[model samples]
Target: MADTVADLLIDRLIDWGVDTVFGLPGDGINGLFESLRRRQDRIKLVQVRHEEAAALAACGYAKFTRRLGVCLATSGPGGLHLVNGLYDAKSDGQPVLAITGHTYHDLIGTRYQQDVDLERVLGDVAAYSERVMSASHVCNVVDEAVKTAIARRTVAHITVPKDIQDWPSSGPRSKANVARHSGDLYADAMPLPPQSALQKAADLLNSGSRVAILAGRGCLTARKELLAVAEKLGAPIVKALLGKAVVPDDHPLTTGGIGLLGTAPSQEVLEGCDRLLIAGSSFPYLEFYPRPNQARAVQIDLDPSRIGLRYPVEIGLTGHCWDVLRGLLPLIEDKSDRSFLTQAQQRMAQWNELMETRATRNDLPMKPQVVARTLNEFLQDDAVICCDTGTVTTWAARHILIRGAMEFSASGTLATMGNGLAYSIGAAVAFPGRQVVCFAGDGGLTMLMGELATIAKYRLPVKVIVIKNNQLGMIKWEQLAFEGNPQYGVQLQPIDFAGVARACGVPGWHLADPRLARGVLKEAFDQPGPALVEAEVDPNEPPLPGKLTTDQAWQFVKALAKGQPDRWDIIRTVVENKIREVV
Candidate 1:
């Protein structure tokens, strides 16, 4: 008998250097699962309890490794379950490949059991989606899927019919077949901006007395070149959330994040700058940016469409950041002015002091900022932090400083809940030696509490810190800011996440008292395997931004007038926090 379609696909995956896959088994994918079992020596399959976890694991793997993350699922409901995680990958611009088993070829499109329009459903999230019909097309489809995912830095999907997965291969079976199909879509050649565009950008930056650089994830590979330009121009670097680790936080010219999750110094840099140099970030919040035409802007992006999307660009260099910056640096004049850089550094120092004070407060219920700052203190230099969406994002973005080889990521565009646990699983799986810590809120942790079982099963060394506020803290603040409305259904019953982790066979620590948080957290981190720390954080603390707009203040006032039972208490807490800011 000739080789089965599953054999060829497995060979291709091995060829692509994929050592492991995250997936769930279902009857529709029986043929594929059986083949995987037979090939267990060559490929490792991590059987997750939910298909969503599989997809999210893949997303987390891709983000942590910067490699193509692969996940698999069965037909119909199984495939649908992978949607959210796939969207998480797509939105974050991570490369991921999803394989799904479909109904038998003849059974497709005839109201077959467990059959869905896989391609159409995933088309929006995947850069490439295809259905494999015959063994003859298997190799080609697999090749295209891997290549497209890598080149586009997005999701690529392929569905294999149950019957077709067991069919005799029409193509060669081993490494020869894989080598023949392997092709580098992104070769050594890098895209560079034209001389005219480069020169014009240099001229604008050279003339400006106050220049600010905003870098994003796109500048990840060009850190050396980025710092050189910043130094030459004497510009303070403001990071987008994705760019948090691009430049060291303690750098003389570095002013933390630039939007609502940004620092006061970062806002100051943008407000006073004459020239704004944006690198590889399509930061969507335009209001937080310098107003249109307020500063001469130079944006560098590989995609031409994104060059002028957020801010009107006086000079747009449509090329890779490293290439464009390298060319532009030579033509630019060095600015010796230290005023902008010195002033930004001073503001950053003050902001740091203020944050430290808030983080060290010994409140009855532990302050979330204190937990965030405590985690920051104990984190290893190479720690990878996976943060859940909600107020947890604010604590992580604002309080945690990225330094000494640290990396932080969250569900950026999609902002999905329960991402911290899933992403941590992927990171731990991908980098078994590196410390993976997840920052989650009670709301987010409860959503995927089952993943603790996955961690226990794999014995993955992941540490999760739950900020147990018993409320959707972010939404509570939003309700007050947007409509001055007293929090409605935002409250959550207190859950002992650490106890849940213990029930799942992972170790747990409960910090009922905030003062013992640091000591308890250190013990949890010292454990050899998966563990959790459930710290009770103050529910009333709001994640106020660097600047609260007038409209937001007015809405808050109106809400207060509507008078909820605890309106006065809530108002008093808000006033106290604001007073701390002014003082």
Candidate 2:
């Protein structure tokens, strides 16, 4: 019989194909930590400086390796710190397992010293959240949670109650769980829409004065087929940020992407279109959207719940994106209109060129845009880039130049920080030989730095490039743009990330010349063990989070003086510059 709860967990994890667990050890989790010490081969645990880094590392693992990522945290505040990272796994559709310890069963409802309601806390951010209510539930729940995480491509939360975790499971635990058989959970698909509905949609697409298609994350499965449909209809497709990779960027029918902070050309084209075919997307921004009376809309989706969620739909077809699109393609008469696609491309090129020009301007401490562009040139196509949330996200979106070679992973929906480090850990573990580069901010790194130890323990070759800007950049930018508050809590004293990595046993390097970045990046990837590459960066820089106007800033100042700023007042700012968000 296994002597400890840690042994039981290790046994289950081995069956789940998890060779490594990225995290730190602490007092609250001492029992499990000790158990891990007993069997170092099956489950190699990574100890990092912060929980956020562990989660970020896990995010990378799931995205690059096409496998479930796992991260561990202790009870109370230790576990609470993983919320940002867990949300990253949730919103980005990464299969991640978040296992956290809970205070002993004896402390239930007694206001235990280190207890937080983890189940409820993880509920909104996780696809599945459950507590090991009893030791009997452990083996089954663990297996099932891992399956659901992979099958659903979302994060699963499993809280291990402290006491029973160490309690024997009554017999030798088996490797299989009821969940191992969870394959293609959805069996019966929604029936096809009526013939009249398809005909009406066909007729509308054929006769509409202006036509376009908007695709979202829901279209991931139907991507290639939908691309065919768009081409046949002469429809220019606009993608939600989450739908960025659905239709290959090189496809001619691809017009531009949509949302707040989205491209100006895309928004203009969408506004001008008379008929908009919504495909697999429930894009959140509604105000920029025209009145229902403006565009005749038709939507096709697998989930009936999304049929009419965003805007009113003329035809709400409850079917998979590809299946519905296949029928729609045959009915859609080819049109010669290339005006929308052309106009958008022209604008995209002009703006893209303009931004590219500004990104390379040499300045002291180095502009992040310059770093992003320069790094992209050196990184191989197979490299995986995990960017932190901050001004760096904006720079990366504009400069990283995703040409299909690299798979980009970031917290798109939750827009959380501290994911750069944690997600990279997972990415490295998932693809041991592939290059994993984490673009992190100093502030974001501190939140998950403890994962450095995790990297050392596992000896996973994950390289982190810390953009050492001494501030909570996104918050500072927000305060400067909207609040007009002289950066308050946003300022941070810089920490030598390279020094920290050395202290943790991972080799470290500090580089200022981007020309040298290529060499250093190559060496790090070639290095047999984990490494950290810290680059000093400018902090006053901004991702320009949700742009605001001068007028809005003045109003916010007055509101601060007057003690109140309404919602519309804040919206006014985000509208002016129109920031584009990339997931």
Candidate 3:
């Protein structure tokens, strides 16, 4: 007898270097369930309570390993739930394949139970969406699904009909056949230009008095070459959010992040430089670019289209960052003195020093910066951090130092609100060896509270730390700045997140003292699993990502003295590098 379709698919997954697929099972995909059961030794299956967790777990694996992530789901609502995660993968350029089950091929148009159109639901977020309508189409569709995911570096949906999974296939069922990609597809892949372009790029740098490199995610593959090129050229490197791991954060030329919530050193360099070298970052938001025509720009990217997409470019070179950089390294003239580079490095050093001083400052209402550092101190390098959307994101983005050992995962682009708990579950389950932490706000946790059951049922070691400020913090701050003041409904009713954790077979911690935070954090991190450490920070705290308006400023003067800033009661509002401790 010929091999079954499930056997064929399993073989392909093994071929693609995938050993595990995350998802909960249902009757709709029984053939796959049985196939997975048989290959228990070769290709294991992790059953999650929610499809969302499964997708997110796949995202974590992809991010942590730089491999194509794989997840599975049954039909209808299960498939719909995967959309949010697929969007995350797509926007962030994570390679992940979402294999979902649909109704029998014949029953597709009849609107049977769990009959939603899988292709239509996922088309917006996925790089490619396909349905296995015929037994003959299985091999082709499966091959395309895996290849598309890698080539596009995004999520793709392969809807395997229930009927097809059990059908007979002409194969030995050894787990290697299903995963092989057609050879020709990868043949036309672009090759990088040689030393010619690098020499030209180096000439511009040699002529310029001051230059800096602004990097993005695209630099990951060629991080070493890019670093060498930057070093040889004496350029300070500034990263976008996606560019975090490109260079070691402790590197001398590293200027930190650049954007709306960017660090001061990055802004100072980008705004004031004579030449700005852009590489591998599309940086969708144009606001992140410097003042109009402020600096001459040179960009190098793999995709030709992205070169001038944001800012006007004086020099645009399209090639692989590694290849181009290796060539450029030889051509760059080493200067006798790097005075310009030294000044930029010093600015970054001051920023780092001030950042540490302010973040560790002891104050009444706990500072977010302090809170993040405490967590960082309490956790090990292998621990996982899943940060939430708003101000919490800024704190984690800026302060949470990611050593090479730890798994630092986040929803980068989509910036969805309810992802904190969900993403944490995914990260924890994806890497069972690591301690997983969710840095979320009260509002974001409430949105996906049901996932608490997902954690309790599986007993995953994912901790949730909620900031219980009882306000729509980011929203309230924006309204106060634009509309003149915080509005109604922005004030949230207090919920005992810690109590809820305790009720769900998990321990809880609630703390307000900044000094005592490390102890509470240690207790929470040290505890078994599934916990919440709620911090009762003042809702109107941190004049942080929180902005004050002209009226609020006037009110601050009317309420207090002339030199004092608007009081949030969290800490003194300061734009300088350090956080000032409130007396």
lDDT values, one for every candidate: 0.85, 0.70, 0.74
* Cα TM-score of candidate 2: 0.78
In terms of TM-score, the best-performing candidate is 1
lDDT of 2 by residue, 1-583 (tens): 4665556666677776787777767666776777777768777777766776667668767766767788888887778888877777776678889888888878866898777888888888887888876444566677778877876678998887677667764544335534334332323434687777888988888887577888876676677778787777667777776566566544566644565335565676687888888987767778545566888889987667778887887878877677788778788887787676677677777656655665665555555666677676656667777777877666665566555555666677777777776777777767777777788888877876777777787776777778777778677656645666545676688788889999999999887764566677667656777788787765534454222446656844554454333334334433422343220
Candidate 1, residue 330: CA error in Å?
A: 2.7
Model 2 vs truth, CA RMSD: 6.4
Over 4 Å off, model 3: 1-3, 170-190, 221-223, 317-320, 381-384, 404-407, 429-436, 450-463, 482-485, 528-531, 543-583
TM-score for each of the candidates: 0.95, 0.78, 0.85
User: Candidate 3, TM-score vs. the true structure?
Assistant: 0.85
